[model samples]
Target: MSTREEILGAAQRRLNLDPTSSMADIAAAAGIGRATLHRHFSGREDLLTEIGARSLDRWEERLDAARVGDVCSSDDADRLRATLVTLLGQYLEDSDDFGFALTDQFVLAEPTLTARGEALAEREIELFAAAQAAGVLRDDVSPRWISQACYGLLVAARDALRAGDVPRRDLDTVVASFFLHGAAAPGKPL
Candidate 1:
């Protein structure tokens, strides 16, 4: 791998493990000197900006691959559910690699990244709205809430995995179920 890619991979892994890790920590993780790390990224903000952009790119790619927009506009409830599950699975698969982008306020709040995230989120909200209109999702909750809840579930799932509270094999199913059926007891009335 290229030196830059090495650094980015190492930094991402290190940060996911310890968000407070310093540049020196990242350099050590990358097996490079601190100076080399700085040569590639001027500072932590610079590094984070790049990571944020890459994370957004991954999110967009996953959405497109899932054909989320097209599925949202379609009348096929089964397709919508399948697409949603696929999209959620993609995020879960990469949660460790890009979880920081979802959790780091600074990364999410970066002006450029913020704009990108807003656009992506708008698309997600549209999907949720379409599903709700089709009776595939709860109509009582706003689309925006559903969209945010999906993200929140991802974060929670990641935490669960990190804490060993959930097994890797069941992560996808558990997350999908919670998002679809929520935590309410079986047969409980809403």
Candidate 2:
């Protein structure tokens, strides 16, 4: 990788461990001097913007690779559920600096970044709507609601993984069950 890429990679790794980490921390992690880090990234905001863009790119690539249309055609609900599991898994496994910064409060607060996030979210909702129209997903649930629920599942799973409360291997099944069926006990109306 180029020096800039290496620095970005290092910064991203530190962000994963602690989103609030300073430039000094990133420099140390990257094994470079602070001046060198600054040469590549003039400031924290500059670095974060790059990371945010990169993260969005990675998400787009993953979404494309999933071939969502094929799965949706086979079984819309299952496809939607599987797509979410895949996304969460990608977030958990990604080593890019942008992925790490995704957990940061500042990143979430940035209007541009948040807008990009929302656009990605809307894509997921479209997928849900496709499933709903196919009758695999409950017609009573709105695409917006299901999209929010899907995001909630990802956040909860991430927190659970960080807390060591849930095993990583169980994430896919857990998320799938919740989205496909829901948490209400059997015989109870949803």
TM per candidate: 0.96, 0.81
- Span of 10 residues, lowest total lDDT, candidate 1: 1-10
- Compose the digit string of candidate 2's lDDT tens values, residues 40-119: 88999889888877887876777678776566666656566556567656755542324455466777778898898888
Candidate 1's residue-wise lDDT over 1-190, tens digit each?
A: 3478778988999999988889989889998888889999999999999999999999899888888878977878999888888888988988868877778878978999999989999988888888888889989979998988888898998899999999999999999999998789999969
In the predicted model 1, the residue pairs found to clash are none
Q: Judging by TM-score against the true structure, name the best candidate.
A: 1
**Cα deviation in Å at residue 158, candidate 2?**
1.1
Quote the positional error of residue 90 for candidate 2 in Å.
4.3
lDDT of 1 at 39: 91
Task: State how far residue 69 of model 1 sits from its true place (Å).
Answer: 2.3
- The local lDDT score (0 to 100) that residue 176 gets in candidate 2 is 70
